[model samples]
Target: MEKPRTIPSVFTPQWLPLGSLVLLLVTLALALTGCAAEKKWQYLPATRGEERSIYVIAHGWHAGIALPAEELGDELGFVREYLRPGRYYEFGWGEAEFYQADKITPAIFLKAVFWKNPSVMHVFSMPAEPAQQFPGADMVELKLSATGVKHLKDSLRTSFKLDAAHRPHPLKGGAHGEYRFFTAQGYYLITHTCNTWTAKVLASGGVPMDTVFTLRSGGVMRQAKDARKEYLKLRPDRAEQEGMQ
Candidate 1:
């Protein structure tokens, strides 16, 4: 009897070396240019708050929150020790590989979405005001009660993943000298992005936020705009500062 021919299994292991050039030009288009083509809000100067305030800042496809470093309670000294002395602290969470990569690639992005990748919390020390530190970013200034501040800080502490020794796991230095990326508590998924994390952080402090659909930086900023209007409505002085009736 003639032996049966075995089907080749090697064909299944595709060489991802040619993900785009081989096929799916339109899919490649969506993967490559979609992020850049999305709308990005420009930075607008907000009248500085005389009291405690939180800033929701959007930088292109990412979103982060800013708070005065000195204002944080001693409970956050774990994070503070890793950062440089600065006026403001900006914190955000994202996929480890994609966030730290000097350049984001389609493979990196797809893997982040498809795989259960580890997350990271990026803390950047800003020497000046957030507006000055990131001239091109979009910002929304929010004023909160003492309770709100406490809740927000507590939520921030929750983002950092503690080690067996009860300390935040330091990953690597940021692209600049003033930043540190620590191992974070959550996994990055297709639906839950860095912007989603910002939404969750803002919502924890009782900000008027809708986190469900805030998958993009643009969406997070739209909610920020809404929060600004809502907070201004409550403060006649701030409304007047904005020249609002």
Candidate 2:
């Protein structure tokens, strides 16, 4: 008989595999937890007062006029579902550092948009730093008429006070109160201020109004603006004879 045969521990082989599996599971769990923790929180812009709010109106290729801001908010649901096709709404507040003072300026902004067939419309408020000062908000309604684009264009000029000639050119891009028509797409972007840095992207891609508003309030306006410009460039040209300049 040989010397007693040496035997390995009965649990040793199983223990290593089991331990490895458990380690792998724990690593995966920790990674997932880390990812969840890293997710960011989205915030809505604040409103100045109950009476003062921003409203955006979109009619499927039709023409319309501005209404009071409060009235617009109350009827937003009806306008979004019945008057337009896809609906997006958003509101929020933001704060910017004051260069001269030790204080911060609180700003509020709102946005809405709708899509119907060949037409898409967007409504956004002027981003007001120290928003409390602006007691009144503007309500802008844009209609894209598939049948008569010219009539819609004229209405925008007359009703919204959009003047391509007198529009103020921002230091870099277009101008304030300047409404430019993309004769190719039959789409126009009108802004009261340069705050439009992101409005263009949201309107073109049909991004929900809420997402755009939230992004802007978070100081990601540049990203939003770039997205809009890229999307608009890729869209089809507006129907010829669709409207007037």
Each prediction's TM-score against the native?
0.76, 0.20
Total clashing pairs in model 1? 0
| Local distance difference test, candidate 2 | 0.24
Q: What lDDT is obtained when candidate 1 is compared to the true structure?
A: 0.69
RMSD in Å for candidate 2, one decimal?
27.1
All-Cα superposition RMSD per candidate: 13.9, 27.1
lDDT of 1 by residue, 1-245 (tens): 11221211111223256565435532432343222123222222233343468898776567789888776776466776787777788788988888877655668756865688889988877778876766666788877766676777888889989878779988787444567889999898766778778878887777766665567666677777876776666666778877944
What local distance difference test score does each model get? 0.69, 0.24
Which number leads on TM-score?
1
Off by over 4 Å in 1: 1-51
